[model samples]
Target: MNRTLTNTVKPDVISDFKEITKMRLAVSVVFSSVAGYFLGAEVVNFVVVLLLAIGGYLMVGASNAFNQVIERNLDAKMNRTKNRPIPAGRMSVTTATIIASLFTILGIVVLYIINPVTAMFGGISIFLYTCIYTPLKRVTPLSVFIGAFPGAIPFMLGWVAATNDFSIEPGTLFMIQFFWQFPHFWALGWWLYDDYKRGGFFMLPTGKRDKGTAIQIILYTIWTVVISLIPVFGVTGRLYLTPISGVLILILGIGMLYYAFKLYKNKDEKTAKQLMFASVSYITLLQIIYVLDKFIRIWI
Candidate 1:
């Protein structure tokens, strides 16, 4: 027992946690889950919300850890990912594998305690992100859509976790994130096209910085704004966009669309980067606006 204990694994648990979590990505996903919960939850259920947050983080983090493990070699070829913990040799493949499995199991169990639907989505998200997305990246640009399905789930998962049911409200959340991905992701594609190319990944549609891709970005940006305002209409089938909230969302969406338009018109690296920054802020702000609008209605 002592000899086995001596040989038992010891790691810099702190750094390993950070590395396995893709700390920044997990943080962003958690914020989205919280916002989605607030936006859709009519009654605040602190316990379920907390579970969803932690479960969402663990599941998403596991996805990222497995991705890094699979792509360590390809990541080493790309400037952006060359310094990742896996490729940079700070963490071993064995350690990463164990962490990924534990997170998935723990995350699903937590979500299951909240509600079966939450568990289902969380499980599928981890599966899609790892089994589907990780490999698709090396195969096709269509992987973006496949990956977006999992990426877009956080928005809806929060709503379902809160209501213990799936409904159009969560669907609205899903659509917003779904449409937002095109411009947001394509903008990153523009900025990192070269780095991605070095890794043999064609992320951009045009496969080159050209008018076609720019036009596509503009179109998707517009679509993102359009769907975001669906809550304002009385005739949208259970989803009504109140006039005031509609206007606020419109302004926010237009703010984002304007940047997308600028990037399309300019087709320069700086413009593309600016659009990417705007898109990040745009989604975050949109979620804030949604939650605020929901609260404002009750208060007013």
Candidate 2:
């Protein structure tokens, strides 16, 4: 009986840890950082890359855990978030806070080993996400704009980790991710508008998923596509892309843009959800293309 109880409790604890850290989302963030590392490093360092992945994940996870703690009560009010570990009574606030604190410390130390600049940006990401964006979510839709700062950091953070410098290359990477977030998140905001409303969170630009929000999504999508092509013109220093890769990225951008337009035209939950998924695919593929292009260029 005691063995059975121990086994059951162990699994529940592990599951709760996953929930508190938002494991999938954290891993996705780590992917972005690793991709950036590859793009920036002329010669890849596998050890540094591994450290970046671990540090990135821990930082993102810490931010998410802290967010869950802060929003536990509000999360309980929303159907979408009601089943989260904290809201479902599977975890205590004190336990979550302790875990977040440890993650924060360890994440910073690991990133600092890469470079001071990388660690500084990582710290900034956590601070902005937890201290600023989390509270602003309930007060204004501008929170999304504020949130983009931290969200964009991971991509550039990897670049800084590889190069140990902050320059136009990383800045351009930052801009691309920064603009991409508006369309990606606004689409998500539209799809989850009703659920978000229950938590008193303002996500959409116009706060009601109307034409204004759709227009903003379209504009940002356009900006994301345009910025992504800038590296092809030999203006972004070490971040130049081959003409072939540039054209391929443009095509990918247009594919995502098509879904954004669909959301604008349809103005429904299904369309918004489609755009959200498209945006995710677009960013992921774009990173893969960038890394692949660099390797191909090196090999040839």
Candidate 3:
């Protein structure tokens, strides 16, 4: 009876931990950082990549955990977030706080082992997300703009980790992800506008699914495509893209742009969700293409 009780409770505990950390989102963030490491590395270092993956995941997880802790009461009001561990009453505030604190300390220590610069950026990401972005969400829509800073950091953070330098190469990487966030997140905000309003979060720029918001999404999508092509001009230091890869990336951008325009025309939840999915695919595939193009050029 005792053994069975322990076994039954263990899975619930693990599930709660995964929910608190937002394991899938953390893994996706780690993937972006690893891809950036590959793009910046001259000779691949498996150990450093492993360390980056671990440290990046921990830092992202810690940020998410702290976010949940800060927004626990607000989260309880939203249908989407109401089931989360903290909001659902499965986990106490004190327990979640302790877990978040442990994650923050462990994550920083792990990142610091890589180098001071990498660790510093990791710390900044957490601080911006928890300290600045979290509270600002309730007050204004500018929170999304501020949140993009931390969201954009992981990609370039990997470059800094591999090269230990801040230059045009990492700056280019940063800008690519930075401009991409607006359309990506705004689509999500549009789809969940009601739920977010319940949580007292202001996510959209215009605070509604209006023509103004759709136009801005289209504008940012255009900016994302343009920034992605800059490396092909041979001006971004070591981050040059071949013509072939540039064309392929252009095609992918056009595909995402199609969805962005669709949302603008339809102005409905389903269309907004489609744009959200397209934006996610666009960013992920863009990173993969960039890394693969670099490796292919080196091989030739």
Candidate 4:
């Protein structure tokens, strides 16, 4: 009876742990990093790619776990986050801390084996996400701006992992993702303003869900679209997009811009939600287009 009960209870623990680490979120970040790796690698090493994915997931997971630990109280106040492990009383702080520390150490070790620069960027991402962005969320709207730095790193870090260099190419990748995040997150923030306020997070630039915030989202959407096209000019070192890819990315960006404009025109929660979904689609499709273009160039 005892053995059977323990077996049944284990799955619950696993689910709670996964919740604390934000597995789906971590996986999306890993996908971006993997795309970067493929773009920068001249000859892909499957083993190194595997290490990068594992290490990236570990680092992101650790950061998320730490964030939950720090924000357990605040999380409990928010409807969306109230069910998280720490906030829901499903996991102890001590257990979460141990898991986070283990993940951090293991992640860094695996990345370091690839290259010191890769490991260094991974460590910085975790520190910024957990130590800086987590606390700053309640203090100022600029927290989202600061958070974009670490958020953008995975795209560039994967490039560094592939090339083992810090150059204009990686910087371009970083810049693209960095700009993309503003509109993406701000739109989501607009839709979830009430929930975010419950947890004392000020994610929107204007600190209110109004025309001002929507305007900023629109402007950043424009910038994101423009900057994404820069690589097609052949100015960003090794990062060059062919005109075909550029047009596809342009179409994708325009789709995001359309929704951003709708949010601007309406300033409504439903439009903001639509913009949020469009932003997600924009980035994912853009990444796919980029990888496909790279492979096309290689084949030709």
Residue 28, candidate 2: Cα error in Å is 0.7
Q: Write the per-residue lDDT of candidate 3 for residues 237-265, one digit (tens) a residue.
A: 99999999999999999999999999999
Q: Which residue pairs come into collision in candidate 1?
A: 231-240, 231-241, 232-241, 232-242, 233-241
How high is the CA lDDT of each candidate model?
0.84, 0.94, 0.93, 0.92
Order the candidates by lDDT, highest first — what do you get? Answer: 2, 3, 4, 1
Q: Say which prediction, candidate 1 or candidate 2, comes out ahead on lDDT.
A: 2
Candidate 2 lDDT over residue span 40-84, tens digit each = 998899999999999999999999999999999999999988999
Clashing pairs in 4: none
Candidates by TM-score, descending order: 2, 3, 4, 1
The residue pairs in collision within model 2 are none
Q: Candidate 4's C-alpha lDDT?
A: 0.92
Using lDDT as the yardstick, the better of models 2 and 3 is: 2
Q: Ten residues in a row with the worst lDDT in model 2?
A: 256-265
Leading candidate by lDDT? 2
Q: Whose TM-score is higher: candidate 1's or candidate 3's?
A: 3
